[model samples]
Target: MALLSDGHFHSGETIAQQVGLSRTAVAGHISQLSDWGLDVFKVKGKGYRLERGFSLLNAESIKKHLGNTKRAMIDVESVLPSTNTEMKKRIANARHELADGDAIFAEIQTAGRGRHGRTWLAPIGGSLTFSMYWSFPDGYQSMAGLSLMVGLAVCEALKDFGVDDAELKWPNDIYLQGKKLAGILIEVEGQIGATAHSVIGIGLNVCVPDSQYDVGQPHSDLTSYLGHTPDRNSLAAAIIKSLWTLLPKFTQQGFGPFAPHWEALDLYADKRIVLQMGEKRFSGIDRGVDASGALLVETQDGITRFHGGEVSLRGNR
Candidate 1:
C-alpha cells in the first residue's frame, strides 16, 4: 500500500517481491483495497495504481504543526469503528491519561455516525474524521452554544487553508455553495450540577472518491475548490490549533463573542428555509441566531427561537 500511495503504478512481481508475498496473494490484497473506497486502476501489463493517489496520515507531522502551545494528547489510528465512540471509552477507563484537550483521529471509520442517527461514510485517506474531548468547568446549563462555537472555529480554520467561501448551516453543518462540506456531532456526558465533558466529532471531506452508497445530500470536497488535495495531517493540525485558541475564549465569554462571526458565515441568513423537528415542520426566513445561538426564525405568525436538539434546518429545495 505504501508503494502504491505515491500515485505511481507498480508491477505485480515487484510488489510481491517487496512484500514477500505470492503474486496471487498480492492480487487478492489489491482487490480488497477497492472495497475500502480506494480507486485502484489495473492495466493488462502496467500493474496497479490509485486513481487519485493517497497521503497516509503522519502523527509526527501533525504534532510538529501543532507546536508547543497546543497541549493535547493526539492519537492516530488506521481504522476505527468511530472516533467519538473510541474517545468515550478512553475517557471512561483511561481518564488519568486523558485531559480536556485530548483528541483521536482515524483514517477510516467502519461505523461513523452523524446527527439524528445518520450514518457518516468516510472513505479511507479521503476525509478528515476525528474527535476531541473537552471538559468545561461550568455545568451543562452554561454550555448552550458550544457547538456553534466549534463551527466557528472550523470555519476559521478553513479560511486559513484558503477555503474562504465555506458557510455555516444552522446547528452543526458546514456548507460550500449549498453543498455539504463538513459536519459536526457533539456528545456530552455529565451530571446536571457538575462539570460537563464534551466529545466533539468532526468530519470534513477532503478528497473523497465517488461512492455507490447514497449520502442523501449534495456534497463537495476540498479538492473541488483548492485545485489539489491538502495534506490531512496539516489540516488536522490547523483545526486543532484553532480549537485550542477558541475554546479558552468560549470558556470565559460563552457564545456571545462568537455570535457575530457565526452569523456572518451563516448560509441561511435572511433566506427562506424549513426547520424540521421530528414529524412537524416550520417555514420561515432566517434572521440569524440570537446571542444564545438558538436559531431565530420569522414565520407567518411571529418570530421564534428554536434550540438544536432534534432540529434540522434546510434551505428551500
Candidate 2:
C-alpha cells in the first residue's frame, strides 16, 4: 500500500519483489485494500495504481511535525474497527501500562462510530481518524466543557492551516459553511474526585470523494473549503499539539477561559435552533455555551441550559 500510495502504477512482479511476496500474494493484498474503500486500478501492463494519492499516517512524520514535544507517544495502524474502541481497550485492559497523551491513528475504520449511535464511515485515506488517551487527575468531575475545548482546538488547528472560517457547533462538532466537516466523540472512565482516563476520538473529512460523502447530512470537506488541507500526518500533528496544550491548561483553569472562545466560534449562536431529547423537542435561540460548556438557549419560557447527549439537532434545525 505504501509503495502504491503515489498513485503511480507498480507492477505485480515489482511489488512482489519489493515486499518479498509472491505475485499471487500481492494480488490478494491489493484486493483487500480495494475492499477497504481505496480505489485501485489494475491494468495489464501498468499493474496497480491508486485513483488518488495520499500519505498514510506515519508516526515519525507526525512526531517531527510535533516539534520536540515529548508529551505524546503515537502509533499508526493500517486499519481498525474504531480508534476510540482501541484506546478504551488500552485503558481497560492495561491501565497501568499506558501514559497520558497515548494516541492511535487508523487509516480506515470499518465500524467507526459517532454520537447518537451513528456509524462514522469514511473511505481509506479520505479522512483524519484517530483517538488520544488523556488523563485528568481531577477526575471525571474536571472534564466539564472538555469536548467544547477539543472542538476549539481543532478549529484553531485548521485556522493555522489557513482555514479561518471553521466554526464550532456546540457540544462536539466543527462546522464549515454551516455543514459538518468534523465530529468528536469523547469517552471517559473514573470515579468522582479521582483521576480520570479518557479517549478523545476525532474524525475530520479531509478530501472525501463526493461519492462517499453522502451520509444524509449537509457535509463538506476541508479540501473543498480550503482548496486543500494539510497531509494526514501534518494535520494530525497540528490537532494533537493543540489538544495537548489545552489538556493541562484546562485542568488548572477549568472551562471558564475557553467559554469566550467557544462563544466567538459558535456556529448556531443567535440562530433559531431546535433540540430533541427522544420524542420531546424544544425550540429556542442558541445563546452559545456557558462556562461549564452546557449550551445556553433562550426558550419561550426563559433562558435554559442543556448539556451534551440531549441536543442532537441536525434533523431538527
Candidate 3:
C-alpha cells in the first residue's frame, strides 16, 4: 500500500511477484478494489495500475499526526465509495458504534457527493475526500449555523497550509482568487427523540492541476494555486486536528465564537453581489454573516438573512 501510494502503479504480476503471492490472488485483489470504491484499471498487455495514485489513507499515519485526537474516534480507509454515505449508514445502524467526533477518510472516493445533490468529482490523487461524523448533544436546531462553523474550520486548515488568502463563499464553499478550491457538505440524521448526528463532508482540492478542472467551474487546487503541494498526510492531520478542537466549541457556543473568523474570510464581504436562492434571485451588498451564521445581505428592500439551501453568493455585475 505504501509503495502504491507513492504515485505509481504496478502490474498484477509485479505486485504478486514482489509480495510472493500467486498472480491469481493478485488479480482477485485488483477485482475487489472496486468494492472499496477504488477505480483500478486492468490492461492485458500492460497489467494493472491505478489511474493515478493517492497517498493511501492509513490509520497509523493519520493517527500519528492526530496524536491525542486519535483517541477521540477515527476510521481511516484506503478507499471508500463515499465517506459521508458510509457514516450515514453507520449512524443509521447505531450511533454508539462511532463516537461523537468520529471521522472517515478515503484516498479515493468512487461515489462522493456534494451539496444541492451535485456529484463531487474526486479524481484519483487529486483531492481529499473525508467525512467527519459528529453527534451534537444540543440537537440540530440549537446549532443553527453548524455548516458555517465547519467552513470556518476549513478556512483555518487551509491557512495552516500557507494558503492564507483562501476565502469562504457563504454557506460552505472555499475559494481562492474567485475560484472554488474546496467545499463542505453537512448531512444531519437525527432520531425522532434522540440527538442529531452530523456528517461533515469536505472535498479539498489538494494537488489537482488546472487541466483537471472540467467537472466543476472555475475550480483551483491548493497545490496548483500555492505553487507546491503540502504532504497529504500533514494536510489531513492539520484539518482533522482543527475539526476535533472546534467540534466541542461549536456544539456549545454554536457559531458565536467563530463568527469573527468567518467574517474575516468572507469572499463577498462589503461587495455588491447577486444571491441565487432556488428560483428567486436577489441583488445585495454582502454585509457579512450574522451571529447565527446566516448571510446578511443589504438589499433594495432592506437587510435579509439567509440560512441555507442552494444559496449562491457571487460578485455583482
Candidate 4:
C-alpha cells in the first residue's frame, strides 16, 4: 500500500522484491485492491499504479504528535467497514475495561457510515476516518447537543490546518467554502446507574479527486481548497486533541457552553432551507438552534423545533 501511494507504476517484479514476495503472489494481491476501495491501473507494459496519490495513516505518528494524550490509546487500521461499530462492540463487552478518549482511525472505510442510516463512502486515503470512545458518568440525556459539539471539534481541527472558514450544517456536518467538507456521527449507549458511553465517529474529506464519488451532496476536500494535502497524521492528532479538550466541558455544562459558538458557525442561519423528516418536508428560514440543541426553523405556520432531520438549502434539488 505504501509503495503504490505515489500514483506511479512499479513493475510487478520490483514490487515483489521490495516486499519479499513472489511476483505471482503480488499479482494476486493487486487483483483484490479494488475490494478495499482503491483503484489500481494496469497497463500492457506499465506494471501498476493508483489513479491518484494517497498516504496511509500511522497510529504511532498520530499519537506521538498529540499533546496530553497519555490517558487514551490510539489504533490505526488499513481498512474497516465502520470504526464506530468496532468501538461499540468493545464498549458492550467491557465498558469497565475501556478508558475515556480511546480511539480507532481507519485508513480506508469500505462502508463508512452517516446519520439517519445513510452511507458516507470515500475513496481510499481520500478522507480522514476515525472513531473515539468516550465514557461519561452522566446518562445519555445529559448530552443533548453532542453531535454539534463534535462538528465544532472538526471545524477547529480544519482551522488548525489553515482552512479557517469551516461551518457547521445543522445537526452534524462541517462545511467549507459553502460545500460539505466533513461529518460527524455520535452513537450513545446509556447503562444502569446513569453511566453512558458514546462512540464519536468523524469522516473528513482530504484529497478526493474523482467526480464519480457521490455523497448525495456537493462536497469538497482539503487539498482542493488548501492547494496542498495537509499531513493526515498531523490532522488526525489535531482532531483528537480538540475532542479531548471539549468533551469534559460539554460533560460539565451540558450544551450551554457550546451553543453560542455553534450558532456563530451555523451554515444556514437566517437562510431559506428545507427540513426533510422521512417523507414529510418543511420549508422554513433557519432560526438557528435553541439551548437544547433542537433546530428552530420559521416555517410558514410558525417557528417549529426539530430534534432530528436532514437539513439543506431550499430548492437545492
- Using TM-score as the measure, the top candidate is 2
lDDT of 1 at 315: 83
Off by over 4 Å in 4: 18-21, 44-46, 210-212, 309-317
TM-score of 1: 0.91
- Estimate, for each residue in 185-287, the C-alpha lDDT of model 4 and write its tens digit: 9888777677888899998989875476777888989989999988999999999899998988988888877888999999888888886776787887888
Model 2, total clashes: 0
Against the true structure, candidate 1 has what lDDT? 0.87
Q: All candidates' lDDT scores?
A: 0.87, 0.86, 0.80, 0.84
lDDT of 3: 0.80
Compared to the true structure, candidate 3 yields what TM-score?
Answer: 0.87
Per-residue accuracy of model 2 over 1-317 as CA lDDT, tens digit each = 89988889999999999999999999999999988878899899889999988878899999999998765679998888999998888888854477777889998798899997789977787799999888888788788999999999999888778898888887898988888999999999777777999899999999875566587787888888877746888999999988888888998988989999899998887888888887888888888878899988898789999988756754243
Off by over 4 Å in 2: 314-317
Error of 3 at 90 (Å): 1.1
| Models sorted by lDDT, best on top | 1, 2, 4, 3
What stretches of model 3 exceed 4 Å from their correct place? 1-3, 7-11, 18-54
RMSD of 4: 2.3
Model 3, range 1-317, lDDT digits (tens) per residue?
54455546577778888888899987787676645435677767777666666665566777788787548666777667799998899888954588766778877677788888888888656678889888877677766788788877877777777788888888888888888888899898996556888899999988767774586688888878778767777788888888888888888878878888899988988999988888999898889888899999998799999888778777887
Model 2 deviation from native, Cα RMSD in Å: 1.8
Output the worst ten-in-a-row residue range by lDDT, candidate 1.
207-216
Query: Residue 111 CA error for candidate 2 (Å)?
Result: 1.5
**TM-scores of all predicted structures:** 0.91, 0.94, 0.87, 0.91
